[model samples]
Target: MTLTQSRRSGGRAARHALRSAPLAENVRPVRGGMTGGTLKALSDDEVLRIHKAALTVLDEIGLADAPPSGIEIMVNAGARLGDDGRLRFSPALVEDMLGKAARNITLYGREPAHDLNLSENRVHYGTAGAAVNMVDAEGRNYRHSTLQDLYDAARIADRLDNIHFLQRPMVARDLPDNLELDLNTLYACGTGTTKHIGTSITEPANAQACLDLAYAMAGGEDAFRARPFVSNSNCFVVPPLKFATESCQVMEACIRGGMPVLLLSAGMAGATAPATLAGAVVQAVAECLAGIVYVNAIQPGHPAIFGTWPFVVDLRTGAMSIGSGEQALLTAGCAQMHQFYGLPGGAAAGASDSKLPDMQAGWEQMCSNVMAGLSGLNMVYEAAGMHASLLGFCHESLILGDDIIGQALRCLKGIEVTDETLAIEAMREVCMGGPGHYLGVGETLARMETDYVYPFHGDRTSPKEWEENDKPDLIAGARARKEAILAMPCRAALNPALDREIRARFPIKL
Candidate 1:
């Protein structure tokens, strides 16, 4: 062949080789636990002011409605119970507990590869919520979410590269009994994905049963404790300085049973919390600081997430405006508090008020997710597939959210300015001697996969190509990807014998 023909053939072969190459874990464009925090929602002085305000709230206002067990525990650990039945904390005691709280903790997945390291400004996105309904894309209607839907969501999340972990997102409304519901929720989520699983326990009595299931799945108690694959997403506190009675007890049990806890303080602004943005943030921070004190008192250095999930409400309607810009500020501001304490923390983001995954949903989800990542929120819960102000979970949306998160993470990864990345030498080569453009250059080919994040379902075809391919729909693309994933057998990590044993022991609805 002539020289030009040979170069064309060689270029085609090189391109094919690059396409077939495997991406090493270290060089992938984005993955879990990317460091962010470039976006400071609160200035340094502002962060300090918020800290002092939260401490004052804890010291003076205090929280009420602590359970008997909690009251005894804290009373023994420097907290005082008032005659009016409020639990008061001192600044000294709060600081001591903060020092003892775990930092830079690793949340392990069943398959060690999926473990997430939460440290300084490290970000990880995952699914979460207790939505009671599921949006059926094909039927185009809302229906009660069952255990099947929860399991299916986990199945989809398992294959998505951007979703770091799996939290029980939807409630299994089909089961009426609380114990049955909690057990099935754990079983379904644990078995559905090998990634670390999280769920809430209704009653303290069921904590051991859930731990027993974890132990059985992990081969023994020691094995499970060494790297606990499940975490308890405990809503330990109610808004405005009050402890959730039963939820606190559940948190105590889980901590003793070797389960990491997410100290979730979900207060709605203009409703359960203060209407002012700074005031809402103050309440969330104070409530979570109390949780930190509680967890450290129970067991010092216990792995607990400072989850300040303060939500927003439309002032006129008093309904939660989760998709609004105010909600993004609440979440981002809370992340600053987590950084202030130097503790691993989480906050809600990527939820939408829109009912479906339309243009509205896209803008809303992207807004908070990008802000949350930029603020360096450790665990961005409900970062995918939530709608109707968190009342509904959409599978197609969850599928599409994977693509959305991939792009968001790319932003968090930010621009690396190394000698190689500067591309000075490559630019000189192209400008000085080679082709007018850099499209077919070696530097361009080598950096293509590592320098950018391409969407799995996002349409990027030219008009002619789009027309040739029948003008594929976005939601249709997501639905097709969802079906392709679910078409395979279940991806549960539990072996058949252990799975059968757990099934026989508990009322596992899935």
Candidate 2:
């Protein structure tokens, strides 16, 4: 292109950016409903093969490390403690525990609007990570995350229509102690949003403290238990058949305390787990199966998410390649396994390797998100706002990803082909009786709200109009959105008296 053309394009972009950002009209939140079993990546035979293999691994290679009490509990529940000091689950034992597992589960929110029903192939998108660094949108750099930053993330998520639930996305680096960290983490998230919150704890004792805090904020014990707004995202297992003793203890404590649990098994492939995708999945399944037995033994049919989050690694560099195509396939295939067992499950997707939310991050997040949704994943954690391969979190990225997830959910909604939707009558009227186009038709006006998804920051101006208005930067738009949300008074704040009471009771860092 000549310099004149380039100059003209630049002039148009500037003019477009100067105008007020266009907001879509009649846009509403997309609710997750039963969506899949349509796109089956694994055949029935393949699914059965993986199921059998997982059971075999559990029966033969029984988990080597369970807290002694955990072993006794499982043993009492019909699991065999081999002479080798490992607890082996027989196929019958696995089947029995599977029968005892909760089939339909609901992750409750402080508010009724944010409750997530986890039955069948229903999909819900949310944040999930422990990124130490928070992305600075204006400075274009990374900084240590703090309590305020964590609160801001939850607040930002609270406003986003597509980000259904808010998990503890970033770590509070400023807090000095683990207990303080866990308590404040809950404090920040609990106050920041009324949506279902997911958080991790470092010790078993912290469970009661967190529960106490949640109960106080939620009004009382019965009220909190009735709508337990938080669930422990506990990494109960470390790797190939070894229970994380402390996290297991936390799980047991939380379950007994009437809190739901996310039985997370995050094994890194080629390092902590097998390099082959099939092998890693088999191992993850076996580990989660053991987790079920442990949970059921503690309290039969307790609410637990079947979390099998095995990450991919770059073989040559021995580093995580969370954005790779292989990672997308891993999550999709894992969702298939979740369906095989008729269990509500969650797995990681939409985390990007890029440090910045550029073109690379956009594609990386979208690929896994779309696939995970299509694969009938019940819970899609880290579906938005994650960067640097889960090492960093960005508010702007989170806002932009709301758009990405909106589009992905549209894909999941797919096509509804019924007599009314087929539009045979409308089409005949438009083509034969009226205009050739369906431009100003009744059907078009009626389906606009139900059929279409409008993006928040996406620009739809043509080159001429763009030049006439001003060129807008997508990142800047997201920054404006973040600022707008943060500027608002906390919409999900706790009662003033209760907030002060809890702060007095605990070492409230925030």
Candidate 3:
């Protein structure tokens, strides 16, 4: 009987303390930006084939509707505009820009501790969505997501261990004005979390205001540029070879303002893009390659993510099946293309078509999350709390997603083959001289915290124990945790003086 066994047999208070104790950074079993890339959805030859197809798409089909400024920048960088007014890139030009594009970039957080290193197969999971509604699980209903809801979501994400970053998950429908909406979205997310934030702007004119706001938070223009805590999730292209003119302009402003950009190309198969999964991927790749060219032409080596978010459609009804197996395959395949380009890439995952956080949502969310991690996506966006095919956001789901992503990251960590991990000596000791079992052993006790990730909300109780106590509900557990976290005194994400100053100067809704 050891101290560990004594605590193990102790009541719920001891177990809670043990589970709640934080581990040192070096010893944590899974963490943000763990190296994955073990599962290849596409072979090298297949990757090459898709690469060639994408290049061909750019060379022949090209992209239409680039903003005039974008046209000038790309043209000077060797892209050609044809009589059809479509911007076409030569294979050589695409290759040149790809080579010039920034690699191994860092997405900074307000705190240095939360910075993410984006290179190769390093994987990080986080939230992203434009859900207009918030799910009320207890009421079994939904309401328009408000600025306060967005703030609460960010605050919750700030405390979740497995969620790596915070992106604006829902629209502040309460703020009717677009400019107010944009500013408040940034304000809410930034003020709620010290982690890196991702957001979007409605207009190019709002870009300078955003930069100014960030500067105020960072203390100065140079300081903000040196470590941009927020990035613009710019949907620069509208599927199937077309530039979103306004978004392209917004991209230019944010890029010149020293903000990193996510070159998002969200093409829904069967509606906005090709019905075939491979064709959808090809179009997305081509569009993002053109985006790489656009970003590099403006400022060579500018930080940008190769975001290829392709959604699936049932085809029969034409509604998006965001949690379908096809969606997972699409995300995995897009991640492979990102690896092929050797660029930091992102894709959608963990979104569920199910209206509620039920068994369906569980299967849908886990399937994509696990596959995305296995496929080594650099940024797995919309990886938590998304419901109704991304129309609704749930705070409780976000809390549970921390646990889900922890398990996904453990899978990504895989097996460590080492002398100690081999356990042959321990096996011999247990079988011969020592006890016949490995339980209660020193190695087991030592490795317990470092080698395993226990879910805070997930139950592993025996039937007897479950009956002995009241049967714990999973949703109830997550809701209680959420309430506990939200009840704590909110950490000031920006200095009190700075926050007051900004509020005085601008509309700080949060």
Cα lDDT of model 2 by residue, 126-195, tens digit? 9998999998867989999999999999999999878889989999999979999999999999999999
lDDT of 1 by residue, 1-510 (tens): 689968876986786577447689899999899998999888999999999999898888899999999999998999988888999999999999999999999999999999999999999999999999999767778999999899899999998889999998999999999989989898888888999999999888888888898888888999999999999999999887899999999999999999999999999999999999999999999999999999999999999999999999899998899999999999999998899899999999999999989999999999999999999999999999999999999999998999899899999999999999899999899989878789969999888889888777788767975896799998888889899999988777578888888889888877
TM-score of 2: 0.94
Give model 3's TM-score versus the native structure. Answer: 0.97
Off by over 4 Å in 1: 1-22
Worst 10-residue lDDT window for candidate 1 reads 12-21
Clashing pairs in 1: none
Worst 10 residues of 2 by lDDT: 20-29
lDDT (C-alpha) at residue 210 in model 1: 88
> Where does candidate 3 stray beyond 4 Å?
1-8, 11-16
RMSD of 1: 2.8
TM-score of each: 0.96, 0.94, 0.97
